[model samples]
Target: MWPYVAGFIGGLLAAGMAAAGESYWRRRRRTKWIPQELQRFFRVKDSSRLQVLQKSFPRHMAPDAKRGLDQWLAEQGLAARLVGVPITESFINTTGLSALMAPQGESWYQVSSVEYESFDVGGDAPMECPKHALWLLDGGDAKLALFWTYGTHRVGCNWVERLRIEAGFVMDSPGSGLADQVLARLEEAVHSGHAYRGQVLSLGGEDDYRGNASGVTVHRLRPVARQEIILPEPTLALLERNVVRFAEQRPRLRKFGMSTRKGLLFYGPPGTGKTHSIHYLINVLQGHTTLLITAEQIGSITEYMTLARLLEPCLVVIEDVDLIARRRDESGVGEQCLLNRLLNEMDGLRPDSAITFVLTTNRPDALEAALAARPGRIDQAIEFPLPDAAGREQLIKLYASGASIAPEVVASAVRQTEAVSASFIKELMRRAVQFHLECRPDAESAIILQNDVDQAIEEMLWSGGPLNRALLGAGEGREQP
Candidate 1:
């Protein structure tokens, strides 16, 4: 009797739900109110029709996309396996002709037995990427699909990396957008590297990884506080205003229809704190992504700009800009080509882009002045001259790290180090401390007197000769006229 009563109640509940579902459908009410699981019971059409969809991604993004697909498929309970096939090469030889690869339409290669490569994903261990992978999902009455992840490498062509999805799904239902769903997930994978939004990245040459196209190195730089950088008050303020403060006001700048994209030129002798100033700027703009490029990496400017545009609110630092961005009259033909590209990249950025370029160089005269004089190319020019007397004293104290030094000796040393770089002060203090240590190794503290500093200067300037002095930035400490 109890069983009969339960059955009768279940029948009534099902009937009532079916009637309500029909009414909701006819009225077109917001269907989201209905729980997906509850609706699944009523709609039970098994997958039947077969279809395929495919799309290509940038070569650099292929490895990342595969990892993303792996995680997603695992969550969906799909079974996958890699199918490694031997790459084949067919070469035609003639009596007078040398053996050559068949064609893009037909060519083969194998550095190793397999083409699986390991990519560094900014983790303790690298992720393994296979040449080809096939995934199968047999969800009986729900999902019947196969996914393929692979890349295509043509000898001279740029086309690479493709994701293909083939599925047999419930045909033409009100929902069941399988193709769109997979693509949406793939899009997530392709643009998910560099760890986080605000990271320091550099484009490495194609020397390390065998097959990976974009050798992106994640830089974990220590953040520097303002106190650490010893710059003139005005110069420091200019830096803060141009980069840090501007980055902070990106939202307001965009709202007012002003171009947040800007460029900065830093020209001075080497070791004058240009690089150190950039480090401080990095600290202030911790929320922005920074990309560092050496002059040798100018060939990858197109890739770097793409990244800058993708990662907005970005900082691009090109060290020794004069190497490529030289005055047209002084630069060679090759240098001129690169200079044009660099200028074009700067000028082409949208006014709304929050990208800042900080270019450093030792030779200001070498610069055609194209970057600094141009309106859109460079927003501001900041000179990193040799430190003044006051800065020299601070640097000495800073590197000395609370050593026992008298005020008179400090003043005298500062005078002797005139027209030298901040680096010179740093090196001088190091040598002075060494001399003091040699004389008083077991002393309670480092007591660097006038004689100790004088001896160190003599070794650097006079004993070492002109070349050594020039390299060390130990300018001749002649008394003023």
Candidate 2:
């Protein structure tokens, strides 16, 4: 009886193992079989009775559009079926060119399934939903369907979608009618807005200039207020009139037969207010799209110009323009090529086009003559000179707004900071405050003393020697005229 029981137990264990093996094999077979099933569905031969509709979109948006499109189809009261195919590594490796091609005159192709997690409202664990290929059931009436797959184009690994509208014989001109409908939907989606609004977009990758056309890297920037900037009254007014006013009165300018397109150049010593003024201008023109191109991105200037044209009523801000637009003789062939492209884009723009180019440079003398010499290429060349005594006083007050600094102390500091840039005044105020806070950490409010301001200025000037003073816009070692 013991031997019989042992044998019976062993047989039961063997049967259980066999069932598990069978289940595993069945799953593997189904994994391989799905693409084939989709391919077969794609090759239906009754073209005379079927109408096809197709459209493609970027891969990023395909998955997002699925739910909305599915609901719309259901609301239309059509029998719709949606299937997702997973693009497993095994499938990609084994699939051949013949397997990917659609039947003659048909737009269907096998796509890999991707799985996304769906969450329940009760904070339950996520459930996996597989989506690979989309199918619209053909039951007498026309059906709308779409599928997502990798694009065949050489423009990098982008997602492509093929949308279809299949109707049985009742519709005449399915292509145009369906295309119009698709366009209308697309227009609505675009008008709804994009995720990159009010964000800075920089060129991405080395191939950006080589036609790889990968999208830009976005950066969110904090807006700088006008009062936060310290510039000469005339300089501020000039920018307000040309840059801000021009953008606002663009339509009016065109009405008066005036060219709305303008170019501005800001040149001065490093650490001056050129960049700060730009920040202020960006804030002032809040609604307008602004594209910023640094010295490193000069290679993709042409692409930036194209984008500026597309995003009209835009500002193209190029910092350190002298880096690329250097004196032609001093520049290499490549630099010259970039400079020419820059010149051509500026010159080619329509007079009435609502686009402005604001370029800044520290070394104005290094810039190409063609860029600055031409009247229309740069309508205004504003110099961001070292701040005057009054400007320095204002800057000190601005940066020290929260601190307890008397006006007399600021006036004295301004006298000592003659020929200093706005930046130096800012640093001077910062250091003075730091000394005050460190000494009076337990005080209700810190009062910045005259001694603190004097000490900070003395440290900056003497610590780094004359080179530091000159760099800080103190104009050290210059002949006192």
Candidate 3:
């Protein structure tokens, strides 16, 4: 009976040991799985012989970079496929994206991402992009592995915590130099492939204002017609010749060894058509990408210029430039630094680059003398002065919503708006129409009477007070300030 019991215990112990050994062996096989697959795919004896090269980009641009890489690869007639490497959006190995594909030296595998990080990148729908992914790619004689990770981030944080887009290429170690070549092309693609190209965009989001690092927001501006801008004939022609005409003559200018890049200053009081004229230029330069940088965003001018180069035939609108253009000596450290950067970028542009810098400011007297004296920085400074009686008449007629205003009535309103802005007249016409419609809603093309125009002007100039007058673009409103 004792011998029988001992035999049974020994058998049980052997079985348990055998099971444990098998489990360990399976775990080891699973660990080697990805490396073995990569080795076989590259037709190399060892995984160490494979080289992994990578590039990092701003996190906000990760999705764009991925799109660029894919677009560039597709253009090269190559596609990447998975080789059983796992993926997850939240998981990131400190070494690199290689951990998801073929870890460089020491690593583990994490997998399965059914979700994508997506958002509107100048499109109606959000752009869907992989948060983490690995792929095996073959381009004729070149065999490579591609790894991408959205990288890690902490909310409201800077780039310190790996806030970037990591893209890597793994290939044979002898160095076919293929990775470097592909990376160069990929970098260009990332820049040119930006979805914001040929679209109206502005930098926003981050308080730090680190160029593209801050983030991009798209804006939709309805097309403004050539007839819509209300500047005087001389001012209008000068603007068209400097901006639209210059663009058309880019090739000829470059051929003649002249610079295609230009900087124009639009100086005037508020609502005198500086911004309105820019919108017209945008419509005229149909193929150009427009970037609007407010005074607060001036810090990112350098990055904006880099983008302008990539998306050439670009219109860069800088509003209230006088804020930075104040005499540098009188300026604080931060202000002086920004003004220097702005000047440097404007001067740094290539002669043949097709970028037009249009800067707007209300106080030309407050502008830095250096900025005005700088030759290339202000190729032309067009004034956006308050309209005279003739220009005012045109503005009133234009904004009247096709209402038949008696010639006498228009003449009266134009005289009253002598020193007011094109924008003020635009609002005056709107209020006049509202008054007409309120009393005559059923009438088509209601006649705008003198009373209607006068009442609207009273409401804008008197009822709304000084703040409202300024808000409506009224310049002093017949009062000396």
Residue-pair clashes per prediction, in order, are: 1, 8, 1
TM-score per candidate: 0.73, 0.74, 0.78
Q: Sort by TM-score, best first: what order?
A: 3, 2, 1
Every candidate's lDDT: 0.67, 0.64, 0.74
Clashing pairs in 2: 84-131, 84-132, 85-113, 85-132, 85-133, 86-113, 87-113, 113-132
Candidate 2 lDDT over 296-362, as tens digits, reads 7776676677657655767889898888899978999988887887888899999988888999998
lDDT of 1: 0.67
TM-score of candidate 2 relative to the true fold: 0.74
Predicted candidate 1 versus true structure: per-residue lDDT over 332-428, tens digit per residue: 9999888887888888888888899999989887787777676778778888878899998888888777677888988998888888888888888
lDDT of 3 by residue, 1-481 (tens): 9999999999999999999999987987665455556556677656455566777665555556767767767776765665333443443435454443354432455333334555446656656655555666677667666666544554332332232333333444422455666677667766664666788877666443222233666677888998888888999999989998889999998999998899899999998989988998998897899999988888777667877787788999999998888876667888888888898888788888899999899988888887887787889999999999989998888998678898999999987777788888999998998898888879977789998998898898888788998887886636632
